[model samples]
Target: MNDFPWLSVLIALPLVGAVAVALLPRDRETLAKQAAFGISAVVGVLAIVMATGFDSDGARFQFTETHWWIKQFGVHWALGVDGIALTLILLSVVLVPLVILASWSDAERSGGVDGAPPKGSVKTYFALILALEAAMIGVFAATDVFLFYVFFEAMLIPVYFIIGFYGGPQRSYAAVKFLLYSLFGGLLMLVSVIWLFPLSAKPVGEGGLGHGTFLFTELNTMHVDPTTAKWLFLGFFVAFAIKAPMVPVHTWLPDAAQQSPAGALVLIVGVLDKVGTYGMLRFCLELFPGAAKWATPVVLALAVVSVIYGAVLAIGQVDLKRLVAYTSVSHFGFIVLGVFAMTTAGQSGAALYMINHGFATGALFLLVGFMIVRRRSARISDFGGVQKKAPVLAGLFLIAGLAGLSMPGLSPFVSEFMVLAGTFTRHRVPAIIATFGVVLAAIYILWMYQRTMGGPVREGNESILDLTAREKWAVGPIIAVIIAMGVYPQPVLNIINPSVHHTLARLDRPDPAAKIHVAEKVAENGARP
Candidate 1:
């Protein structure tokens, strides 16, 4: 029916669910939670179907659905999936259900010492989460810049409330800081986009004249100058960097991660944060090839700095969630390094890193949240020798922690290695400096493990419960996917490679003369492969 109309459904299903939840009686908390989970589950199933039906060899946007959105502005209601977006969309969808389930007991357990959130809080929470789910999918699926920005900006609202209203001791402070930083970045990006739209709208044939379009397909054809492209790139770049929470812009993440509820933190850090890097891939690089190339060296250097700086910071953290947050800063640095390296392996690794980090980091947050709920503490010093009493929980935490630090045979290891290898090909010195980050990661990860998992059983730890069947069910699949993706990454790489090839091919052709010269040189060298 209408070729699956999948993108619209992906965006709509959860939205419709949110409205239904809003209409339900405030007393029906159980039904509200079930409705939200059911909707997310359906969307997740649809996403899997989309992934399975995806053509590995086609290597083009599939099941695309576009319409005239704003005729006056020349923006179209374009939505579709490529290999890259497909993987990310699937990730967002899969994770939402997990978050709902993971938060289920917590939601029931959180209230005014009565084990229920404030009256109507659960309903509101579930609705906002589902709404956020729809928005995240829209951000990934949107092919129109305007549409993308709309989804991008809209996501911040729900998260702000989730943190400010339902978070920890400093929730209000953390929420405001997070909003301010993101808004600062988003505003700059908005100004940049305003100028970019008209240029993209310029007619394609006229070298000086622009095609006057906001559609990605149309914008892709226009050749932007090196100078104008850089300014425009900064608009998107600043927003992405802050979101990536790169060095000098990462101050907000640790506070937010520590203050927000576990489920909220997972979506904000795991899914929403990826948007910054994804924007770089889909928008800046695609639209401003010259600017991306010009900025590569500087970006790579900053990325290395972020890697080392974030890891060292993580090594010193006492708060468990804050420590996990710092690891994200380090991990994102590698993601950015791989992306800016502009190599096929780097891009694919960056993409895979996004997926793997979500699972690993998200699991870490969930585990820590569970611990906090049990002991009512977030300090690493608050935990010790719990392995004796809660072997299952301890083991899950260990697996997620080791994976976060990029243990060998885990998902992050392959992606992290690929990122470094890819970076080395283009930026050798930065690559080497970044390699030390792996050592730093190991130090911090192992130290955290030893401190939290080792030593004598504290007074309260003797009573700690191992993982419940439900908790195991929640975390088990996450670890399973981590292992599966680590061992057999071909399906993802195959889908990723074509797009990476396409982006690089464009970069290698700044001009026809340069394109021909490079082609000849490669041919004369008999092509390494």
Candidate 2:
């Protein structure tokens, strides 16, 4: 056994930091902010250490920790990391510090004397941000079904407050809408989990829920009827899809994105939203392979609609944040398409897409925030000729915007290509239509760039300064990583492949919709029992 409980350390550090921030004296607001940042930075460092030691070649969970948590329910305090979990956890760590940093000026500005947020509010805000970090890490690290559910639900608390208390004019309404929608989704998932708990209680021969434990490992080994499994699968899918903000359930995301503080927007869209796609992979696909296969065509159709719909909507948006938010819908459609395609390259591409989307989209949101901070506006038409006034800022925006459009040398290009290639191997018609999304992406992305960054310098824009040293530090590395990933994506692919293969192997049921050369049913019926 490993001497240290590293996984626990990851969760505990931030929880403790949050508590510390919460307890700080009102007079020491700056101290409280510093404490939160210091704690988050420390956690980020520890996460990087964990990454260095992570066994990329191995598909099994690492740094695993488990102990009895609730005897009556057979729930355990289990935690671990695979490549999927690792990438998300790293994302959490990376973003928390940036979020804290992003809010520093806003927090102080809002807390000042006239029409500003009170000093006490800053401390509380930072505390909530730290708490959010802990919960996000927990969601990804959890291995037990119960523990995962706990973390999954726990995340909304910080997010709700972040939007409600710190957001724009319609903060309250937006927060409530976000809360009710997510809670509705979460409640459905809770009902599903409650039903799922018993599936593990059966014995193999008697069909007595199979393993009698809530462990994902054990549950993954048990088989459920395809008929009964699809409903359970939908329960999880709806919840995750809402979080993924796919299609109809996606109405809340743009509002939340529009109204939320810059820090919260980064985490919500960049990292938290990924949990939805992750759930589809971890729960829906792995546990209900037959159902997932059965549902692929429908899901793929919705994905195509979202891709086109989001692109079309984005083109019409005046609010920059809302435009970026809609782009995520289109981006997630590609992700979902890759996922349900169920090919090796497709799944890996999906996984890679998550990381790239986070970086690219997160950068876009951050750049927008920076612009809003300087100009006191988020309207696409508010200013132009930014390249002349703030060349570095405009340049970074171009890089991020180009990345969004999936320029060939950017990280998204590699992932998007793989997704298209993999999907074509399975669903040629849908693949062809999905290609239209790329064209749409180019249109919206380039148009947004041209509107915001091109044209003559506006009169008031003359006073605007280029990116600050601190701002450069904040966004530069994110851009660098995007470029690095684009230039050499092999390492990420290598790390992700092992886990993807293992997951696919566990999906033992044949994909009915798949164009298999041999009829699996005929072969099965012909085989000796």
Best by lDDT: 2
TM-scores vs. true structure, each candidate: 0.93, 0.93
The 10-residue segment with the lowest total lDDT in model 1? 520-529
* Clash number by candidate, in order: 9, 7
lDDT of each: 0.81, 0.84
Q: Give the backbone clash total of model 2.
A: 7
What is the alpha-carbon lDDT for the whole of candidate 1? 0.81
The true-versus-predicted C-alpha distance at residue 161 of model 1, in Å, is 1.2
lDDT of 2 by residue, 1-529 (tens): 3346888999999999999999998778889879999999999999988888888866479889889999788889998889888888887899788777767766655421124342337788899899999999999999998789899999999989888777777777888999999999898888878887777676556533443577889888877888879988999999999999899799999999988877679899999999999999888899888889899999999988888899999999999989999999999999998888787767888898899899899888988988987777778888788888899999999999999988866788878877777788778888899899999999998999898889998766877789988788778888997888877777777677677777788775333354432222211221111
* Residue 488 miss distance in model 1 (angstroms): 1.4
lDDT of 1 by residue, 1-529 (tens): 2288899999999999988987888889989889999999999998887788888578377778889988777778898878888888988998898888888855555531223243337788888899999999999999888888889899998888877767766777888999999999999888887786677655456466543667777778877777888999999999999988899999999989887778767888889999988888888788888899889888988899999999999999999888999999999999999888777667777887898898888888888877877766778888898777788888888888888988766778777877887777667798899999999998998898888778888876777777777677767788888777766666677777677777777777322121223322221222121
